[model samples]
Target: MEGIVGYGAYIPRNRIKVEEIAKVWGADAPSYKRGLMLEEKSVPSPDQDTITMSVEAAKNALKRCLINPKDIGAVYIGSESHPYAVKPSGTVLAEALGATPEVHTADFEFACKAGTEGMYVALNLVKTGDIKYGLAVGADTSQGAPGDALEYSAAAGAAAFIFGRENIIANALESYSYMTDTPDFWRREYQYYPQHGGRFTGDPAYFKHVMGAAKGIMDKAGMKPSDFNYVTFHQPNGKFPFRVGKMLGFEKKQIEAGWLVNKLGNTYSGSSPLGLTAILDVSKPGDMILIVSYGSGAGSDAFIFEVTKRIEKVRDLAPKTRDLLDNNRRYLEYGEYAKFRQKIKKAS
Candidate 1:
């Protein structure tokens, strides 16, 4: 079974508190703080974007594995915020990682679940023996309208996973997906920010698909919530994963290790994968983990993995998700954030 050989995550150092964004919009800070349970989210620098972050994360993933760059047969970059519409982000990432000239590359977009989608393809490719290894990344400089609810949560981050059979770290066990054309969230061509149905994103879209996938995988694997050591869900906000976990019979303590949304905000495609990286960083051999991701176009992907002894040897090879989540953070004021995110209008 081809499984995870190495995994790495990159979270931007800059942060903007929910209060800061709330204040800018003349909304009640306490409301969002209490409701979303989010303190701050990540922000990218002017020079940083999806491609750059993906490259950084790929480098980090490579550091944890023994495979030479040229041996990588595929690289898939999944993001809603790919820098250019026409150019393929995977090619740029492959070139930067020295995996180009002999790689199958594609950029995937399925809202937030795009990363896991890439992971599914990469894993299957390796599973079929067509590729020795594959690099799948979920990275995004997530965006929101100036005063939209998403502004308080959309943030930047990236997670890269190296999939191969050799020296497996977290052995992949089972996978499943649930999807529908719910149209709960979308951004059209030339539209800067996405439009989402407010309460609609919750009950019918995110929750429905997330629950379906979780139950589907557990049933297929003949496992229960208590069967796993840790469970991670797409964290669009700090509260969703916890709420969904409880609803799905997972205890808070069982899910807390991967609950990074409060600290780093929602990394869109990077959200669940980033949380999984954090879990792998601290998990011991034989630990079982269940990860599920939700993308608002209305879908979820679930995977069950068992951590291997190899994790102990390579977990420290690159920066752990916690260290990145906790260290070198610089808070951004509304004005500075406006400039950094290019939200300010320039006088001609």
Candidate 2:
């Protein structure tokens, strides 16, 4: 069966807390924290961007599988923050991993769903035996207007997965996607920051599509919430996942393993994919995992993965997601964060 041969995640070391951002905007820090259920968000350095993070993440995935980079048949990267408007991010990523020349590569974008969108395509390519291995990456240097509601939680990170028929760790059982032209969020070309529908992004957009896909997959598999050992939802904030999980009959414990939003904030395309990496790090054989990712253009992608015995053998081959998230961290004030995120204008 086509399944995950290896997987890895990368989160920047620099972080900025919600209080720091709220202070800068003269908003009530406690209210922002309580309302968003967010503490701090990861911040990319002056040097890091979508391409650099994707390279680091793909390198970690390669370490886990110990696969020859030259043999990788395809590379797909999904992000809203790709450095070049005209160039493909996958070409740079493939060259960095030495997977260039004779490899298929493309960049994808669909708001937050871009990452899994790439994963969906990569998996299909591998499953059809058109490629020996395919690399799928979801990464972002997510942006929010300074002092806007989005500033408190938009963060940076990347997750990469390798798929193949042999040496599987998590077997791909079933997958489903749901979409609508709701336009709850968007960024037009030449726009520096994304505009959202505010409260309009809630019921008609996020909840509806997420629930539709999650229920669709479970129904297709003839499974229930209790049938899965772990479940991860797109963590736009710390609140929505828990709220949605409760509504779906998933217990807190089932969702806790992948619930890193309070500390990591929203990594956009990296949200649910990063959560799944954390789950895979600790999951045991025969454990069932369900992951549903929501993208703000009003869509969701859901997948069912069954852990195999191979998981244990390859679990320690790369850095664990939680370890990268919690250890050796640097906390930044709003000033430094703005500089790093290039929110400040420099005199020419």
Candidate 3:
């Protein structure tokens, strides 16, 4: 069966707290904190972007599986914040990983769900025998207007998963997707920041698609919430994943391992994938997991996986998600954050 052979994630070490941001915008940090359930967000350095983060994450994945980069037949990167408007991020990434020249590569975008989109396609290609192994990555250096609600959660990170039929750590059980033309969020061709429908991003968008995909996948697999040992949903904030889990009949204990938006902010495309990496780090053999990701155009991709004995052998080969998240953090003040994010334009 085609499934995850290796997985890794990269989170920026720089962070800016909600209170720090709130202080600049004259917004109430307590209210913002309570309303969104966010504490801080990771910020990319001037040298970091979608491509750079993807390469780092992919290298980590390689370390886990010890797979030859040249043997990888395909590579895909999903992100909205691709560094160039006309160039493919995959070429740079493939070359960096030494998977170039002979490998097929492409970039993908579907908002926050782009990461899963890449994963889905890569897994299917491997399943079809079109390729021996496929690499899919979801990464974003998300953008938010200086004082918009998104400024609190738009963050940076990347997650990469290598799909192959051998030595699998997580066996794919089933996969599903739900989509629609809902206009909950958009960023025009020349726009620097994205616009969202405020409260509208909820009912008709995130929750609806996420719930639909989750339930549809469970029904297709003939399983229920109780059948899975762990579940992770796209976390736009600290509250959404928990709220959605409750609505779907999952307990907090099952969802907590992957609910990192509170401290990490929303990594958009990396959100759910990174959560899955976190869950896999602690999962035992035979454990089942469900991951559902939402992108705000809007739609969701859902997958079910059963852990294998190989997971324990490779989990320590690379940095764990929590270790990258919690250790040696460099906090940034609002002004420094602004400079790094380019919120304040420098004279060119």
Per-residue lDDT over 109-215 for candidate 3, one digit per residue giving the tens place of the 0 to 100 score:
99999999999999999999999899999999998899899999999999999999999999999999999999999998999899989899998999999999999
Q: Each prediction's TM-score against the native?
A: 0.99, 0.99, 0.99
* Candidate 2 deviation (Cα RMSD): 0.7
Q: On a 0 to 100 scale, what is the lDDT of residue 215 in model 1?
A: 98
Task: Please give the RMSD of candidate 1 to the true structure.
Answer: 0.8
The C-alpha local distance difference test score for the whole of candidate 2 amounts to 0.94
**lDDT per residue (tens digit) for residues 148-247 in model 2:** 8888889999999999999999999998999989999999999999999999999999999999999999999999999999999999999999999999
**What 10-residue stretch in candidate 1 is worst by lDDT?**
16-25
Q: List the residue pairs that clash in candidate 3.
A: none
1 versus 2: better lDDT goes to: 2
TM-score of 2: 0.99
Query: lDDT for every model?
Result: 0.93, 0.94, 0.95
